[model samples]
Target: MNEQLLKDLLNQDLDPVETREWIESLTAVIGADGPERAHYLLERMVDETRRAGGHIPFQPTTAYVNTIPPQREAQSPGDAAIEWRIRSMLRWNAMAMVVRANRKPGELGGHISSFASSATLYDVGFNHFWRAASAEHPGDLLYIQGHSAPGIYARAFLEGRLTQEQIDHYRMEVDGKGVSSYPHPWLMPDFWQTPTVSMGLGPITAIYQARFCKYLEHRGLIPESDRKVWCFMGDGESDEPESLGAISLGGRERLDNLVFVINCNLQRLDGPVRGNGKIIQELEGVFRGAGWNVIKVVWGSYWDALLAKDTSGKLRQLMMETVDGEYQNFKAFGGAYTREHFFGKYPETKALVAHLSDEDIWHLNRGGHDPHKVYAAYHAASAHKGQPTVILAKTVKGYGMGEAGEAQNITHQQKKLDDSEVRAFRDRFKLPLSDEQLADVPYYHPGEDSPEVRYM
Candidate 1:
């Protein structure tokens, strides 16, 4: 196209359809004439637009979608069904541990939503990425988010590392047998590798730990190996200056072995974290600007079909435009509300999801809850070289707790579930428990010889 024609096209306020056609035409031209000429022409158009005092729309540095496309995603190496079952069991036990503890006379407090939100994030790592310390290898160092200790304890219980009695004593560490409320090295020196309950400590410590690993290698104190430091933190936790203050150091030092997984559940203790804005986008700009490799896992596999069908990009536009508060409301209110408020915003967007029912929409998940997506991001992050990698995974706080919490502001303090909520939780996970068993809030464990045990 000529310069004047290009200028005219840019000046017009094209609708989505017209914009798509223009994009297709430009792509065809780029394919025919090669990228070099296309780049030059685009730069010239930008310069001309600026010279004419015309406003150019700001393009986001990242898309509001999974950084790794479906085609490029790594196939999960493990049996997904088995892994999901194990994860469900862990999630149930973790919630039950907190619920049962809170029901006691002392009302011992523990966290449910933190672990609930991060189950898949942790499961993917345990199944495919994280390594235990051993003689043969230096092993991966994990700074588990302090509030997520219950989930870790639940997994240990399944592995025969902790007895049922210890599992029963959550947040009762004053007695010698009980587990600590958070990951405290001094409390359980043999088990806990790091103390991370202080909110900002985990992120800073993990950065230094990764840097120190390189220092040890340089000093010839340890052989150069593929040991990684995995730091898990919440979006709220990132608000702490200590959490984000030293990220530039990790980038500057080229701590390729460092991986920070921030669970962007869009929630803090009181309410939504960045309620009016997108936290994932904000953090992406920060990390990428700081010279780090940032991978975003926003939508789950359930969204792949819808996104693929969004030829006009209307669906993505809606996703980008919607704020965190609205997103959390969509989860809290369920599918029917989401259809009306989210897709119903535009005729084109509404028609896109028209074939799906309310139940289908409600079941659609976020990336952090999906093992395949989480695994793909983890796989890519592990292989990434030069810069540190940070995975900004979107999830729902109090994921499966239903009305008792799920995505609510009260989720952080939700410890006990009433009879109906208990039943809902049971049915949601498809736990093999009867209605009568709901009252007791018993921890369901398949026998040692069960397939779940063998798989674990």
Candidate 2:
């Protein structure tokens, strides 16, 4: 098939059967050499499908990266709570922009893209700290990265802090409509995210907030408590001079009440943040030198078995040594590409993962996506004393959305998803409601009407 014809076919909102037919036809003509080649082609076909729908391929907008929640039957009460919150956060991230008027011109509407991957990474820490805080000892969140506001709003909405009407009016300037911006702390009484245009201000602000708490306690103005000031920022944001300029202040003041959660998705708005995956390691030294306790949370459950099997820590070294850009390429290119990159770069590591398929290697768990790892990091941060803490959690941008936006260089600008793509996304989360039902539902509802939805 010609490129134009392929694009045309992909643009159409074809059902699964038609999509398969087109794929089969293309493979027949292309002469599929093996299952891996066919799988790669299938991925390319999906990309075309997204492009046809006006959703830019490899973009990081909500339409491109907002995906279904990962399937996990909760293992414990804590796990169940975390899963419920994560699913709720994902649902809101997906529905937030879709409810807005896409036709609006200029920059006067809900954001086209929400920081889906970044938000999910930090949600575990956010939920835990928020739940534990009380009116007397109030813990606050310092949002360093501006793009992640939607996920914060999603968590708030599920926690009953926001009403359905308010959610429906998100980005609308009308009297009760949720006033839209990257983030506005004034809109919410309890939260304290000041609207910031640049990166690094969050770290500075969080340090000041922590210092203020200390001042209040010393003066007997407030009771001494374990309340913390949690700041969330991207590793890309760390490259900004403003982000790192205030590092010394945290250590100088001995702000143990401060906690920094760096979402190491490793991609800035432009491209990969670091060539090798040493951004975390590099930051570790910077923070430690500046007098902060740096905690690295890399490798999720997927690496558990592999690590357990490694007697000499070869797999861990391979993982750590894998370049960040190479990892992004693996994600953008898919399973076969990752297998080739991993095994090709380190021939000796092949024996460690040889039994696994290309698909298995590609599907390895990321630290940010794994709730258990995130919670554990947060728990450790809370227990830490004497110095400020930083959790360097590795993550994937456009993580769950599949081929449309994961790890692509162009994710920041692309926006909006077509109907079929939306339906498929819902199905992945097991929220397969009919078009009629979805249409009839209000912008925000109790969600009891649908088996899988429950955000209203």
Candidate closest to the true structure, highest lDDT: 1
The residue-by-residue lDDT of candidate 1 on 208-242, one tens digit each, is 99999999998999999999999999999999989
- TM-score of each model, paired residue for residue: 0.91, 0.74
Candidate 2, which segments miss by more than 4 Å at Cα?
A: 1-77, 81-95, 98-114, 131-136, 141-144, 174-176, 187-193, 435-456
Summarize candidate 2's per-residue lDDT along 1-456 as a digit string, tens digits: 875467557668457567668767877856747556776876887788887885644421111110121222222225555355456445544444533444345434433233566654555555455544567655555654677655556656655676656655556745745545466666654553565556677777777878888999989998898777877888888877878888788888888888988888778876888875567777877888888887676767787677667665456666666778887787778777877777656655677778889889888867776777677667667777889998887787765455445677766443544555455445555543566655433233335444323322
Query: What's model 1's lDDT at 330?
Result: 99
Q: Distance from true position, residue 411, model 2, in Å?
A: 1.3
Candidate 2 root-mean-square deviation in Å: 18.0
lDDT of each model, Cα atoms only?
A: 0.91, 0.64
